[model samples]
Target: MSTQQPAGGRFQTFSAFYPYYVHEHSNRTCRRIHVVGTALVIVIFITALVTRNGWWLLGMPLVGYGFAWVGHFFFEKNRPATFKYPLWSLMGDWRLFFETVSGRRRF
Candidate 1:
């Protein structure tokens, strides 16, 4: 698959980008790390809401991206789609996480 984006230079829709997103995360370890990061992000977000400690909210990206980046660098050996497609990449992350958890996709 082409890791460089489509012929037109950018992804016109999320639906088009999603398949590429899944392809990028082909590594089992990478997917598992991403899932763990997402789960931690959820826990951190809830803790921030419940305790009213807004500082904890700052950890969302750190925890999420930190783990994901490590997985990409060490396991996938590729750059993160997040750098080029932030919003869609985030959506892709959650979608993949849910799919894996639901047994629709492999972890």
Candidate 2:
């Protein structure tokens, strides 16, 4: 895919980007890690709200990216989608999380 973009580097809508995201995470373990990571991020957000701690914000990317990267390195044995599609990767992470949790995706 071409990395070049328009003048402002605009992006397509999330819906348009989602399929590409799924393609990037074709590995099951990598997708699973992304789901777990997204859940942890939600928990962290709630904890941050309850505790009013600024540091919890630091955990957002860490929890989301850390588990995901580990899964990619160990199980998927492939580079992460984040490197090429940061925003869509993040959106896909959460989308995959919800889809799995809601039973939309078979285990």
Worst 10 residues of 1 by lDDT: 1-10
TM-score of 1: 0.92
Q: Scored by CA lDDT, what does every candidate get? A: 0.93, 0.78
Candidate 1 lDDT, tens digit per residue, 45-67?
A: 99999999999999999999999
Model 2 — TM-score against the truth? 0.79
Candidate with the greatest TM-score versus the true structure: 1
The whole-model C-alpha lDDT of candidate 2 against the native structure comes to: 0.78
**TM-score per candidate:** 0.92, 0.79
**What residue pairs are clashing in model 1?**
none
